[model samples]
Target chain A: MILENNFDLKRMASQVRRDIVRMVYECQSGHPGGSLGCTDYLVALYFKIMKHDPSFNMDGIGEDLFFLSNGHISPVFYSVLAHSGYYDKSELKTFRKLNSRLQGHPTTHEHLPGIRIASGSLGQGMSVAIGAALAKKMNKDQSLVFSLHGDGELQEGQNWEAAMFAPFNKVDNLISTIDVNGQQIDGPTDKVLGLLDLHEKFSAFGWDVMHADGNDMDGIVAALEEAKTRTGKGKPVMILMKTEMGKGVDYMEGSHKWHGTAPNEQQLVQALNQLEETYGDY
Target chain B: MKKYTYTESKDTRSGFGAGLLEAGRKNKEVVALCADLVGSLKMADFIKEFPDRFIQVGIAEANMICMAAGLTIGGKIPFTGTFANFSTGRVYDQIRQSVAYSNKNVKICASHAGLTLGEDGATHQILEDIGLMKMLPGMTVINPCDYNQTKAATIAIAEFEGPVYLRFGRPVVPVFTSPDQKFEIGKAWMVNEGADVSIFATGHMVWQAILAGEKLAEEGIDAEIINIHTIKPLDEKAVLKSAKKTGCVVTCEEHNRYGGLGESIAQLLSTNTPTPMEFVAVNDTFGESGTPEQLMKKYGLDSSNIVDAVKKVMKRK
Candidate 1:
């Protein structure tokens, strides 16, 4: 399902943004900030960039795999997974419900089709992606593995442990990206805790580092394609994707307040008006 | 009472390594990962044979655990090797989320368990690993008694799906269990049958319980000895049947008395049978630098301690 045209990709991204805000606003108990921030990148990855299967299997052999390390932004993940045809888009309404598969964090416990690991405690997804990449290399499968992480989540020490592991082992089959939104739940990441020069840090740890604009649909698709070309080299690739805290909505944009807070009904109507509903809403 | 003896003593970790190698030979999906303790974990053989299948994470237990979980996503059975302390406490969140909660088929093989880790002192010795691992939902906890049982368990868990915690020790204990014995996941092995008192033992303490049984036979106590290898899905049927027949119970282990084999049994019996019982374990304290024998004696986990506990428990009965 590779959408090579930029128009189609942007349209899907608009619909995904609609799903993200509606799902969060309907529940009033989800993170809309990071989810909106990472929407274009996920939409591009699932629809255009990555070679994946929507009819998912646990053993995703010979296909590209994506792991959501920073699982708090599950609204975008669930929306993207649904729009990508992994499950019913109507299941999006069940987000954070009692028996719903869409947990507060992305988990494989409920047999969710796309989610392969349970995450939310923070800083565990990289290791899991590396392990899956290692398994791919062992099975002689040439397919690549992709993972996304939050920039604030790098404060955890376990991420550093994985940061050292992937490149040292020449895990060239993995391309991990960090959502550099610079905002956490409390405040800005720089104020909460400084993550000084992630590009230099990851490069020092021996990864081929790249940077891209996460909000731009065309740039994200191009960066992902370029990242694919960089695979099978000596080192694993890291993309420092710079995105806004709240990307689409007007009042939420560039603010840390909406990182986890959902919009009110009037605000949701305003947000929906701001972004045209490209496809029918779930 | 049945007689039990061994001509040689071997560390249970060696059995794990042997079993891992055999499992790797049997199934190519069985991969091994270590946290810079390959020599200590006795994983040299597995690494030597299947270098491509082995991952040396260089002292990152958390990464190793999560990576093991990730490997399962692509249909690989990963066996993570490290000391019990690092295996459980240090990376508990990683195991709880990625492996246990995610239901990944990762075998967490831990060596140097309990006070028997000896001269490594309190920091390295982890007496609460069994409790920590067993508490996780969908985690199968197995503390094998000896070399053969550990090896059998290592191979057996590779076939069984989902998460498992296999705990062994650093000390060279008796290899009394048969080399040909098939390891059942939650089944208890009846070591000896008697009527006075039932002694349930796990890990290194099973051998000590056998010695206690011999001593009790001389005193006409006729202690029933049962080896409880799997601590999580405990064989409640075997435990209650033995308790009903023997009327009294004693539990032996080389772990802390607070949350180890003894507590599991006590919780079971207190609910179901409510039989009088005594525990021979480390009394909720840290272990210091000493020989394995000296630590066992000082911590009241020796065969003599089991004998004393049996006698005292019988009095309560």
Candidate 2:
């Protein structure tokens, strides 16, 4: 899929950040800090890197597939999926509401367009991604499988289980990215539990590890493209992306307090003013 | 009561192995994953026949369950093979989130259920798996009675389009059920017909119930026997029909009485048609290291227990 220059990827990232704050404010619930932090990475993946279809099909047989392990950041995922034409952007209004396809966490139960699995429980996406990659190999489909996970969620033992299985099984058609914002729900990840050398840890687990600045669209796109090249070479790839807790909103930045709490109306206005309205609000 | 005779005895896990091979031949989409218990799970034939479709997930049951959920995404029918304890309780959160709640078409084929696992002690012998699996929404729970029925169920669940938990046993028992009998998901098979009492049994308890029926017959008391293969969907029509005829019920299973077949029958009867009932199951206790026969006898899961339950339930009516 060729990148459409006319549709500026950076501009789309700003719009997605705006959507994240507004949706969280409207619902009076949801995680805005992580959502805003991960906006640029998701925007780059959907708009620039991934060769997926906006004509949503659950079984992404011939298309690139993605799973969200840290599903609390549903705002950015919902926004990118909508703005990319997976669904109507107007449906963003139903986020976290009863009878809404946009659930608090990503789920396939409601027949949501882009989501393939329910992943709020954490540390399950990489394993699921590996399974899909294995299926793609069986079917001789060269499409790659991608997944995003939280730095804190890596504390879950299941991720390490998957991390071990992927390289051992030679699952080369998978690319997993970790949002290394250094903050979790409780506090900063280092204060909570230090993940001293993430790259070395992944390297020890037999994965091709790379580093990226998640807040920068150029760096995010470049790292994702580099990860793709490393595939089909007898190992799985991992990109440790460094980002801020809240990249756009001023007050919410650099703290774990806004990890789950929604911004109030006045705060939402302040956040929106900071993020240029490249696209109109839902 | 009618007598049942079998030329040989085989473990239900072997039946699963045979059925897996057949299912693989029938559909190219059938895939198997094992958590480092291939020989115990009896999946060698499948792995040998279709090497590419088989995945060795090692000792990680959580990863195995989640990966099975993922394989279903690209239209692969994934059957995860492991011990019952590891299959259900050990990785329940993964099954709940990725498989049950997402409604993935993954078959959890669990062997070594109940006391019949033998000598592995209370830790490996999971008596509460039925309750754990049955409580999950969109999960089909099936505990086949014998080898033929287990083999049939293994193939049958592949055709069903939702999460399924197929529970079987490790000990070699009578292959009394037919080799050619068709397996239906929520349908009950009437073993013997009588008016005195109705005996509903599943898994290893079916043979015990049959034996109990024969003993009751010689004593001039006729007993009706029904083999309940599928536990979740419960075959309400057949259960209610038998309960209405006999006016009393004796539910038997190789599981805990609190959340097993007996409790499900009680809930069904109390709501639609209240009836006198007795339970022939492990009374909320764990099993210890012993032979299958010794454990069954000690835990009151033998034919004598069923006969006692039948007589007790008859008096209440």
Candidate 1 i-RMS (Å)? 0.6
Model 2 misplaced stretches (Cα beyond 4 Å): A1-3
TM-score of A-chain in each prediction?
0.98, 0.97
lDDT of 1: 0.93
Candidate 1 on A91-173: residue-level lDDT in tens?
99999989999998999889989988998999999999999999999989999999999999999999999999999999999
User: What TM-score would every model get versus the actual structure?
Assistant: 0.99, 0.99
What lDDT does the true structure give each of the candidates? 0.93, 0.92
The digit string of per-residue lDDT tens for model 1 on B1-317 reads 79887999999999999999999999999999999999989999999999889999998999999999999988999999999999999999999999999999999999999999999899999988988998899999999999999999999999999899999999898999999999999999999989999999999999999988998899888989999999989999999999999999999988888888889999999999899999998898999999999999998988999988988888898
Off-target runs (Cα >4 Å) in candidate 1 are none
lDDT tens readout by residue for model 2, B79-133: 9999999999999999999999999999999999999999989999999999999
